[model samples]
Target: MKLLRRRGAVSLDDRLAALEEAADLADGRLEAAAVAGARAVVSRAGARRSLSVDHTVAALAGATGSGKSSLFNLLSGTALATVGVTRPTTSTAQAALWEGAGSGPLLDWLEIPNRHEVDGTAGGGPEGAEGMAGLVLLDLPDHDSIELAHRLEVDRLARLVDLLVWVLDPQKYADAAVHDRYLAPLARHRDVTVVVLNQIDRLSPEAAERCLADLRRLLDADGLTGVPVLGVSARTGAGVAELRALLESRVADRRSWADRLAADAGAAADLLARASAGAGAGDSGDRAGAPRAAEPVKAPETSADALAGPLTSALSQAAGVPLVVAAVAKAHRHRSVAATGWPVTRWIRRFRPDPLRRLRLGAASAPEGDAVGRTSIPAATTVQRSQTDTAVRDAAAAASAGLPEPWAAAVRHAARSRADELEDGLDRAVATTSLGASRRPVWWRVAGAAQWLVLAATAAGALWLLGLFAMDYLRLPEPPVPTAGEAPWPTVLLLGGVLTGIVLALLSRAVAWLGGRRRARKAARALRASVEQVARALVLEPVTEELSRHRRFTEAVSEARDEVRPGRG
Candidate 1:
């Protein structure tokens, strides 16, 4: 029996621990803590040794003057607990130990100092007989005592005892306070409770039988019908031996310990299951209604087009015609040269600007007197601060509208906050966008200047060489040497000037295109980050919070039940 009780207690503790862990995972921390506390209490109760005697340990509990003490003394063959006095006498718990192996540890754990070690007299018998071993009789204080300590002690010890012998005299057996406060609440523990009709000696046999039947009916009404009932008289010892024999049988079997622990665990499991079910119900709302698919709207695509158009237009205009056309023409020329032109020149031009550069329309001026016509050049529109801000705000609002109520509000707030951050990023992007603006690196400027100088020097050399070749080929007479102020315009020099202007235009366009792409990438990244933040705030966060709140409410309900009815079977 002792081994079984310990095992049962361990099993119950494990179940309680598992329940608490589940509660924690479900975000019911408060409930989990409560369950943990309950588990600890139960573990302590389980660890406390069971009565070791050969007889079954039973506690006789009742209201004041119910003759429970008198019945205890008559059964244990000693006047250990005070009786027969009108004054409330049993202040602390008292125990009567029949010859037993396990009674001492259990009594010590119960903190019952007063003990009567019975020998082979009264109900005591052979050390290992049905009536002798495993019995630890407890005379608990009146549960109805006005003294709070007495009631508390009685209630505290009630949970640990194996069998509760509720002794009630004929007069107060049907008392409302007793049945409502004690019996009805203990309905879950009915299997371990045995109601005894004490003081039946005062009634005639027929009256006693009728009273016993009425008591049984009351117990049934109290939801305790299945619990055994015995009519007895402490003064006459009527039915005492029968009760003793029943206790002996219970002790011999040793299954009641496990049964009691299982009952406790089962009750706890039921409560936990209900809580889990309630949590599931709360979560089920997600699947209850028709799935509300977000209606696809054409407006977002339109808005994207609207927003991108201005920026693209601005880029095209900033990159003028001389830059765009010249870069494309140069790339095409380079490709042709690489395929059919001299190998040495092809390698040299490999470092030259490609067609993609023309798309960029870089910030560079055309050569003087060689400028492309304004009509052929696309002009870039300067982006206004206010216009960009408005566009961003509108986009954020459009996304926020798709969210649920409270979440929608939170999304709006987040959008507004994030919009400010995005605007700051946009400002930085714009500031960094122009290659020739305040953000231009020193190396780029130096490189541009060096390239221009090299082109100028090359043009001068080409002109000089072309002039020499033309003079030699035409076999023209050396005309009179002209003064520096009188020098004629050389066709070769003009052609070289044109070529240098073309090279500069192409380089400018390539730079502009690269800048545009970089800005576009940055803008796209910022937009994506902002959208993700809004989604989390508006959808996921709200759902998680609601689920957590539901868990807490369920826990509160459980706590309320426990408070209203402590020491449940």
Candidate 2:
């Protein structure tokens, strides 16, 4: 059992390693799903210990009246189990332990209580009888029984046993069920199974020999050509000693367990190979058409370029400036608004229209009462914005359509299911990539608020100063005038506030610009990573898996060739 466990662990480790490597090379949901499937296979394989010594059980399965129980008794050298004259004698399983050196622990694990001590001191029946160790023989219910439970027991134990010694009587040696269901299904396990024409005492020597040959032919038809078929009779003890020697050889070498595990591993590898074959063709095309190739084709001012002229034109119109004058007008507006000037006049300028707003760009119409006293933008701007959105959507759809059927369906499902996440990723990527960090910072809002407050204060101070100067210059009634010095105090406060606000706003803009630059760099890196991930999953990973499958298939074909070659040894 421990040896079996170790072998299972090794197989599981190899499978897990392969899966991890594949996962690293893959991408997206396919990578995740493949990794999950591989892990499941590994876990199941780990749970199954192939041909363990603790389970060194061999089922004595045969047709009714085949003397299967008598043979089982002969092998164990004990009549501990009942042998009935009825056709379907053994209705349930009865295990017998062959007590030899190192057989105690194995038998205990197999839970077989009936034991027989085959002594070299008294036994003259077979030479080399001492070699048979750790063999637990099970007397299974008759295979040809009408009772469903008997057949079920045989079928169940057949799968769990390390070896199977199928017993057939002369009367029913060619039973269809025995050959088709039992023999054919286990053709792959030929090394660990044997067939015996039991109760051969009823047939003549010539008839027995011919029956054995026919059985071998049947086995060959079932794809078990190399498996041994022997004629044996429990009553005469004919060929029982030779069968015992074969069993002894199996116990001595412990090669059956290795052979069984190898067969199972080969089967699992075949499954993986088939899956790889199915995925191979799709991988080739996807690799050749990766998304990053679009970048060079869409480069600035190139024939393939579609963004520069349209984007610039759209932004110019949106900013309410003529396409040629938008850049210059934007600079002038910034200088005029930000420059320090006489406190009273600057306060009055706060009520004037922003130059950008005055250019009348943006949506077709500005909001009624919420406007900055600007006219509506031109109709062409709205049309251009709509066109840009449509173009982007159409391009995305076309790209999605070009994917393979299943993959395209999967992409569509993902897009629909995770639209919000995709949108967020796109927005973040665009903003960070296109806008430098220095131009957009959180502190800008605070700075803008402070600048407006200062502007209001300056305006109020200028109004007070003007009233005081007017009263003195025109000799008008000084109605409720506080003092002449009060005007200077307001002017000083206004000037100080304006200066501080201007400095803070300039600092905020600088910080915003720096932040935007950093964000843009980060966005570029993320986009590249995303593109690479898609390329690997859609192209490289599938191709590698397919190639691996093809190589394994070639190796299997080569092995089959070696197995079939005449006198290859």
Best by lDDT: 1
For residues 1-569, could you state the per-residue lDDT of candidate 1 as single tens digits?
22322421334434434434434433432235334534544565456423442345578899888888988877777778788556466777887776655566777777888888766765544543434466787899889887999999988787777778899988899998887767765565666788899888999999999999999888877767588889888888898777777777776676555555544544443344333333321121221122321211111112333334443332222333234334434444444433333222436766765553434333343455553322223333345435444544454455444433333343344435544343333222232232322234343455456445645656675676577678879998755433335543454444555566456545655654565455445434433333334333433244334334334433433332222234432
Q: Which segments of model 1 are wrong by more than 4 Å?
A: 1-10, 19-28, 31-39, 49-56, 124-129, 201-225, 236-238, 262-569
Query: What are the TM-scores, per candidate, against the unseen true structure?
Result: 0.53, 0.51
The lDDT per prediction is 0.55, 0.52
Cα lDDT of model 2 by residue, 298-392, tens digit: 11111112322343333323322343133223423343334333233446656766433443322223244443332343333566546534433
Candidate 1, position 23, lDDT: 41
Scored against the true structure, residue 269 in model 2 reaches a CA lDDT of 36
TM-score computed on alpha carbons, candidate 2 = 0.51
Q: How accurate is candidate 1 locally (lDDT)?
A: 0.55
